[model samples]
Target: MATIRIGLDRLPPAARAAVEAHTGPLLTVEETAEGFNSEIAARVTSATGTWHIKGLRADHPRAWTQRREAAIAPFLTGLGPALRWREEVAGWDLLGFDVLNGRHADYAPGSADLPEVASLLCRLGETPCPSIELRHAEQRLEHYVVRPDLRFFAGPHLLHTDLNNANVLVGDHAAEGDRARLVDWAWATRGAAWLDAGYWVIWLIAAGHTPVSAERWAAEIPSWHTAPAEGITAFAAANANVWSEISTADPDPWTLRLADAASAWYAHRRTG
Candidate 1:
């Protein structure tokens, strides 16, 4: 479920003061609506520089997510937006990230951004999983997947399991390698190297590709080959179940789309 978004102006005076201490005078504040989790999401500019800020109240139920992102940010150099600073004051926990000059990746068929996304995933595969506390992929899907199939998800790999297109930013600047960068690390997991590729398959299907076509795109990531056929099948089925639950509870159009996509992939995996 989406959190009720609040503008920077609504922050307590102490919290606002703390943010200004880092940003200098706030020249502009553009509240963004792309993400679902953070109550405070916006881009701010000052005499110094620009930053994308996200925050939640210290007492919020999801406050831990801010800490998770902060903890995981250091190891994500070259893969995600750099975390510039973090503040906890006046009951709010906030993170400021270097602003990237880019747009959300388009997942539609034949989009040029596809190759860039694949390249990003390739780079991510080479990053070693940091020994920080993180969730295991199998444990997350334990309720939806057959217990015996959990072995397929066990591996010492850093996995950005959320493959939502909104989480990917692609810059056309060739000097910057034209790579798609990932954001939103609150749900980062430790899992089999291949699992992130599998996650992308569902998003591809949601973007209008047939299940076979989606799997073909997944193959672009080298780690996809490490996944056993049966394991992929199990993962597909489990995701179908997960999305079913998600859509049933929220019933949002995007959730329904992903649910349909997951089902389509599971059906294809079963018969193929």
Candidate 2:
């Protein structure tokens, strides 16, 4: 389904008033073209400072997703943007994130930012996931993989299962610790340390890496090097199935393209 975008003006009067009260008279509201969960996503600047406000109608199917992001924010170290505030503005739920100084990381093969992302993934693997009712990696792909092994995917590590290039931000050149910033924690989960690296493998291929090259990049992470072969295969197969289902449901160009990429990676895992 196409994303439904909501401008600032579309917010309920009371909600708008509530936001302005803290923001001190909004100067500019720029809609950001990213993510599917939120109906309202804008870079807003006030007389005081700038913030990225992401919101969804409280009754929307994905309304609960924002709550997950909000809950997970405090636990993330370098893995995600800081959640500055959260509010229920009228009938809509909203979250304000501290706007960072960076551009979306480029994921094309050999991009300099790849190493930073890999290092950040290691940091995420080290962070203990907060106790929340998170979906297990094994449970997430249950219907797709045959005779799923619960032991393979279950772990205490925090996993940002979606690591698309757009969700990663390359810190400004002048910033200390030019670490890549992960964002969009809506799909955050508790799983094996290597699970998130598997997710990134699919994206690396989609971003133009050959199967060998993608695997090489993923190997940079210590957890990924220690990943069980069976678990890796199961995760790859499951990811392939999920993308295939998504392509079948939508048949959009990008979905189909990524489904093919996942299939290719799965094939490589099996045949090589």
Candidate-wise lDDT, in order: 0.93, 0.85
At residue 51, give the lDDT of candidate 2. Answer: 94
Pairs clashing within candidate 1: none
In Å, residue 200's CA in model 1 sits off its true spot by 0.4
Q: Give the TM-score of candidate 2.
A: 0.96
Q: Model 2 segments beyond 4 Å from truth?
A: 173-177
Tens digit of lDDT per residue, candidate 1, span 1-272?
A: 88899999999999999999999989999999898889999999999999999999999989989999999999998899999899999999999999987889988899888888888899999999999999999999999988999999989999999999999999877444446899999999999999999999999999999998888889999999999999999999999999999999999899999999999999999888
Predicted candidate 2 versus true structure: per-residue lDDT over 147-186, tens digit per residue = 6566688888888888888898888654444468888888
lDDT of 1: 0.93
lDDT: worst 10-residue window of model 1 = 171-180
Cα TM-score of candidate 1: 0.98
Runs in model 1 lying further than 4 Å from the true structure: 175-178
TM-scores of the candidates in the order shown:
0.98, 0.96
